[model samples]
Target: MLVQVNFLGEASGCYSGGMQSQSSQSNKARRRKEGLPAITPEAICDAAISLTKEKGLEGWSMRDLAAELDAYVRVIYYHVGDRDAVTSLVIERVLSEVAIPSAASGWRAWFDDLLRGLRDVMRRYPGVAKRFALVGPGGHAARAIAETGISLLREAGFGELSVPAFSLLLEQTCQFVAQEDDRDALPSLRKSAASEYAACAGVPGGMGDLSKSVAHATTSESSLRRYYDDSFDFFLRTVLDGLEVRLSNMRG
Candidate 1:
């Protein structure tokens, strides 16, 4: 089960800073006169998420977030501390949307559902998938997913290897999604790579069966989205099959 985050709603409770400074008071007064709603930490995070959706997580800055909210840059700091803090919130918010599968679905099926959903969600917010691949999922939103995944692995006889198995599954999946995001950002590079591979395949006696293996992938008839989807599906199935073999060996 996952905890749902409020993306657009105001958070409850007073600001934890104890009391507002004179400048903070003046800022609030100006906002009142200008008919702007009071800013909250949640609101600041919401704006950051929107900016990330448009310009990617790495492409936007605190200045851009401030401009989006029509507030001073310090206002973003006063509410959410800094860009890092806001980034954490944005990641949490994005991850909260990941669909968790039922334990009754069995271990392999459960992970298949979870990873597919995760790929779709993470792909919507560029660079966030790479962060997950590098640092792992660090926020509250990812806790339930980890817990359930490990429990299923243990039940499936991973023994002391449960943690490592889960880590490998997630890390590899996120890396694939991150690579897709990067490849998508550079269409020309992808086209160039395809062309070069096609040329390599055309060389007489150079590539043998390997060229035949790559011929379908190099075809320009398929849409880019279709190519990515087909490739991701193949990769997912292969990884799951490999894990199943590993599980068999462990049992033996």
Candidate 2:
């Protein structure tokens, strides 16, 4: 005499029924075993950031990440939903790494510290710098940085009316830093441009002057660096001076 059992909507009465139900149950068990844990959105985002840093955006893939973490591709769907979510998270994480200095010091000192810290983080991850520039900051880090800037301006005697202008100044400064990061490769770009221009100019007789101008423009690295530094300093000082004037007005 044999007992009967039922599993997975299957009946098991004797040998044959028992074998069939056992097979069904085995299949269900296997499926259950294959399933991954409930990874959170934050964990998925962190994994994406690590992947992006290791392999770059072009090399990143859901399958690759799943394999790396010993997870099924479906597991990613439960957390991130899509590649765009991953990208948004990546930008957020990168920006979060930028530390806002304490408000203990004067506004100028605080701003300088924050900007320098941001610059350092951006330089560490060039891909983030490029991507964030295009995305335009909007997540937690962006909001925090924005609020900090607003507070700094307020402390420096800027009226609520002028907070927007200060925010714009900070944003523009960040944009300038992003643009300057690209300039690290500008010398090579300029060389390639000069070569192309020379090839075209040489084909035409009267374009010799144009070729000279291109060559001259590409030849001077000292001038480019000096100009960059000078322009950056001038812009920063001018903005600070404007803030000072605002503070004076508020004081009076």
Candidate 3:
């Protein structure tokens, strides 16, 4: 004899219990879709990305996205499932726009070019970068980076050992780029934070002080550009040094 557990007033048998909820959800989705305005997943993702850019990831919500796109919140759910799925789709779309370096440039040059492109893209879309960190790597962008890393490692003569390490390195580089990009956007973030903090602190126009602080902290764009160039060069050199050591040992 088997005991049946009641879940949400549904009889829980061996097979019917688990699928009952899923079936109900499917029916609900169908009912909701009847005569609803059609919104594509891509449109939802794009709208979400846009909202993120104007208002940081922390500031974004499904309702905000819906307002930006001039669509119903339910349409977003119908098209993209939920917030997590929408974020994933947004990252995928942005990364897909990145141009992968040609193989003819040789592995080292190719990897450098690829990473630079990634850094540029992340900088251009600071909101996407923030979301990317929380979501971790997924979708076509990750696949493209992995495939390119593997090919580069093979060209550099690392055999199978370099594949996983190279992938990890690429992820680290992305994370670093995201951080650096956020740093550049700190002034705006600080202003936003200050305004919120001021409202909570019962201080009128507290955002002004915060804006000044941000201005003091953020360096000139030219200086930041120089820093970016120096940092990337240092990172590439360090990676190449490690690769060279491994190659030397292998040759030995």
Q: Candidate 3 on 1-252: residue-level lDDT in tens?
A: 122322111122343364545754665576567753345665666677787667656568888888876666755654455676676666776787788888887777777787778777776666666556566656454787678778778877888877766765666676777777566568687456545654444334665665554443334556546756777778877886777787879878
lDDT (Cα, tens digit) per residue for candidate 1, span 106-211: 8999999999999999998998989888887674657889999999999999889889989988988899989988987887877787766666776668574556
2 versus 3: better TM-score goes to: 3
lDDT of 2 by residue, 49-163 (tens): 7777676643578888777655656555544555655666677777778887888787777777776677667655545665655666554547877777777777666777456
TM-score of 2: 0.58
> What is the descending lDDT order?
1, 3, 2
Maximum-lDDT candidate: 1
The candidate that wins on TM-score is 1
**Residue pairs with backbone overlap in model 3:** none
**Local error of candidate 1 at residue 86 (angstroms):** 0.9
Q: lDDT of model 1 at residue 40?
A: 81
The per-candidate count of clashes, in order, stands at: 0, 0, 0
Cα miss at 134, model 1 (Å)?
A: 0.8
- TM-scores vs. true structure, each candidate: 0.85, 0.58, 0.67
